[model samples]
Target: MASFVIEGGHRLQGEIHPQGAKNEALQILCAVLLTPEKVTISNIPNIIDVNKLIFILGELGVKVHKIDESTYTFQADDIDLDYLESEKFKKDGSSLRGSIMIVGPLLARFGRGYIPRPGGDKIGRRRLDTHFEGFISLGAKFRYNKEERFYGVEAEQLHGTDMLLDEASVTGTANIIMAAVLAKGTTRIYNAACEPYIQQLSKMINSMGGNISGVGSNLLIIEGVESLGGCEHRVLPDMIEIGSWIGMAAMTKSELTIKDVSWNDLGQIPRVFQKLGINLERKGDDIYIPSQEEYEVQNYIDGSILTVADAPWPGFTPDLLSIVLVIATQAKGSVLIHQKMFESRLFFVDKLIDMGAKVILCDPHRATIIGLNHQSNLKATTMVSPDIRAGISLLIAALSAEGTSTIHNIEQIDRGYQNIVERLQAVGAKIKRVD
Candidate 1:
């Protein structure tokens, strides 16, 4: 296993760009299987999860061409559907949560999809009920093998139907939309996830000759097409990574520039950081954050403690809540970090507390942070990265702490962040990866 050795209290300054979104890449990559034509995708982040999916696609006999580190053209003209039932796929597919996405396109075009229970983060109970339920509504037969812990869905030909999602799961919506795009009849999906990632996938599907309407909204209507062709698409910059940089700049008191951020697409991200008194200005496509000695959290007009919670799309992303919690440890006022989505994500707060940050773990979903206000610097210590978001948040804490810090289980970080050590090093951060 590799770990990060950080010499703390190093002020970093330089321009940084957020890599292509990990969530978006997973959905878009899986969509290539919907058409036999060549689908070109650029700005694909070279991370562990995305790479794993691309490799799985190749193993399934999708013709893959690597244009550059960030671009790929995939032609699924010849697919080995039998690979889904092979032992090799069970082992490989079980390692990545994104592998579940392969099911939608496979079942749509080939009539059957099989996958082992997928794995990714241990955040909480990320159930697949929504995804399978959507498939079932679309006339697919579902089966589970208890001994093997495998899930399979099959249908001779899908006929679309109207359904309302129990939850606005982003991946669920993507999977359902992908499957619905090829169904025989019209599909009306109410209460769908309208995240930028979903909208991007919808746009790509439309560009490929599918008919989809009511994009960027909770209700989506898809008139199924017999087939889809290939098209070119580019992923948007990762907003969560950009938000993480904002917290990093504030915690380390560093002046930084984040280039090519899709400013308008960053709903509530900038405002949420601004609420922490972190001053950032949008200079064209770049965001400039100046060095600040102190920042105070904002309270409601009624003089109540500010509570930051996660919600569905058009709301603050749950992925950045961990970053918000860590940076709050140094703000002048107290704030409640409500992680409504995942139960165990707040478990990393114990590590932050060990680093000398004042935090109260209310429960699995809530924490109260009393900012140290720069009058006190966090004491550095060794910790372990629990998940992708928690790992980055801890890295920010380590960089702002007074002494050298060590973070174990850094592979969790690499699962989502693309060349994180290299990027941080370029921006003057004293970080290095070691075995």
Candidate 2:
């Protein structure tokens, strides 16, 4: 295992170009199973999760070729669907939650889908009931053996139907969309997750001849198609990464400009940060973060303490709550951090507390952060990362601390951010990756 060692309190000042969306890349990669033609995707981030998905695709006998830097071509012309039941496949497949997405495509094209429980962040109870419910709604029969923790779905003739998802689960919605794209009739999915990642997937599907409407909204209508032909598409820049950089520059009082941020696609992230009193300058498509001595967190209109919460797409992203909470520690006022998505996400605040952050853990999902206003710089400390966002949060917290801060379990960080240390270093952050 590797760890990040950081000598904190260095103000970062530079320009950074966010990488392609990791979430979008993973979802798009699985779409290859829906076609036999060659699909070329550009601007793919070299991250752990994407690599694992590509590895799983290889196990399924999909021909994956690296054309050049940041480009890969996938062809599912010769697939081995039987490998879904292999021990090696199941073990590796269980390592990522995104692996569950393969079920929809596999079942639609191969008549069956099988895999053990998928794994990713241990933030909370990520349920697949919605995924199975969507499949069952599409006339697929599901069998789950709890003792073995394996799931199998089969539908003799998969037909599209109208469904209101039990919940707007990101991956569940994605799985359902993949299944619906190849079904018999038009599928109307209400209350769907139309996050930027999901919208990107929908666009990719549409480019392949699938008819999809209402993208970037909760309502999605998909018209089933007989076959999909491969198409080349470039991925959008990662908004989450851009948000992370915003938080990073805000915390360090650093002057930073992020290029190619796709300002139009950043649905409400800018406004959400504005509520936190973070000033961002948009010149063309670039976002500039001017250096500031201190910024106060704005309370609600009533002057009561504010609360920053997460919701589905067009709402604030739950994935960013961790980073927001950490950034709040340096602001001028107190705020409640409500993480509605996961139960265990707020537990890591204890580590932040140890580094001089004044936080009250309300429960597994909520915390209150009282800002220090840079009055007292946190002392460097050693900590272990809990999840992807939490890991990056801790790293950012470490960078603002006074002395040396060591963070273990960097694999979690690498799973999302591409060359984060290098990028941070480019901006004058004293961070290094060490084993």
Candidate 3:
């Protein structure tokens, strides 16, 4: 295991480029299995989860070649369909949640797909019912192997049908779209997830000869295609990382510029930070945050205390709520953070409270933070990273605290953010990774 020893109270300056979107990379990588032709992808984030997915593809006999540091070409011309039933595959596929997405493309092209019980951050109950249910709706036979804790889907030939998802589950929507693109008839998906990742996946599939309409809306229509061809795709910048940097600049009173942030796709993220009084300037495609002595949280129009909550896309992302909560510790006013999507994600506030932040854990899903208003610095402490988002949030808190802080189990952070220690160091953050 490794840890990050960070010296606090240093202001970071200069420009930092956000890595490619981690979530979108997962979807795009899985989509490669849908086509036999070489699909070149640029801006691939070199992170643990993505690498693990690539490793899984290699195990399945997909041809993967590295074109550059952030580019790769994948061809599924010689896939080993039987490899999905192997014991090694069960172990490898269970390592990341994104591995479950492969079932869609595999079932679409090969008529069968298998997956072990997937593993990821234990934030809350992330259900796979929506995914399997979508496959079932697309004329696939779904079965669960209780002994192996695996899921299997098979169809001689998938016939498209209408499906109204129980929720706008991102992975579920991606899985259904991948499967529907090759079905025999038209597939209509209502209440689908329309996040930037989903939109980009649709565009990439369309470019590869699939017909998908309503790329940026909840209703998606996919016409079955005989086969898809090769295409190049460049993923958008990581919005979660952009939001985290914004929070970091506000908490530490630093002047930082996040480059190539895909500003239009950021939706309400910037406005959400602005409500906390953080100053942001848009320079073409980049976001510049000026140094701040203090920032004040804004109240509602009716004079009630302000509340920041997570919703589906077009609202505040649940992924950045942890960062927002940590940033609020230094703001001038109080705000309630509701993590409506995940129950256990807000429990990390106990550690923040231990570090001198005034936080009331209303429940597993909500927290109310009373800002210090720069009155005092947070005292450093030893802590463990419970999950990816919480781990980065604690790292941010440690950077803005007094004295040195040690965060253990940072492998969780590496699973998402690429070269975090090195990237932060480039901007003058005093952090070191230790074995």
Model 1: per-residue Cα lDDT over 52-136, one tens digit each: 9999999999999999999999999999988998999999999999999999999899998889999999999999999999999
Provide the lowest-lDDT 10-residue window in model 1.
105-114
Model 2 per-residue lDDT tens digits across residues 1-435: 999999999999989999999888888988889999999999999899999999999989999999886899999999897798788887988998888999988888888998799999989898899999999999999998798688999988789899999899888988999998999999999999989889889999999989999998899999999989999988899888999999999888899999999999898888878778899999999999999888788888889998999998888998889989999998899989999888988888989999999999988878999999999878799999988999999999998899999999999999999999888899999999999
For candidate 3, lDDT tens digit of each residue in 170-260?
9999999999999999999999999999999999999999999989999999999999999999999999999999999998999999999
lDDT of 2: 0.90
TM-scores for every predicted model: 0.99, 0.98, 0.99
User: Model 1 scores what on Cα lDDT?
Assistant: 0.96
The TM-score, computed over Cα atoms with residue i paired to residue i, of candidate 3 is: 0.99
Q: What is the C-alpha RMSD of each candidate to the true structure, in Å?
A: 0.6, 1.0, 0.6
Give the per-residue Cα lDDT of candidate 1 at 106. 90
Q: Judging by TM-score, tell me the better candidate of 2 and 3.
A: 3
Displacement of residue 210 (Cα, Å) in model 2 is 0.5
Q: Over the full model, what C-alpha lDDT does candidate 3 score relative to the true structure?
A: 0.95
Better of 2 and 3 by lDDT: 3
- C-alpha lDDT score of every prediction, in listed order: 0.96, 0.90, 0.95
Model 1 spans with C-alpha error above 4 angstroms = none
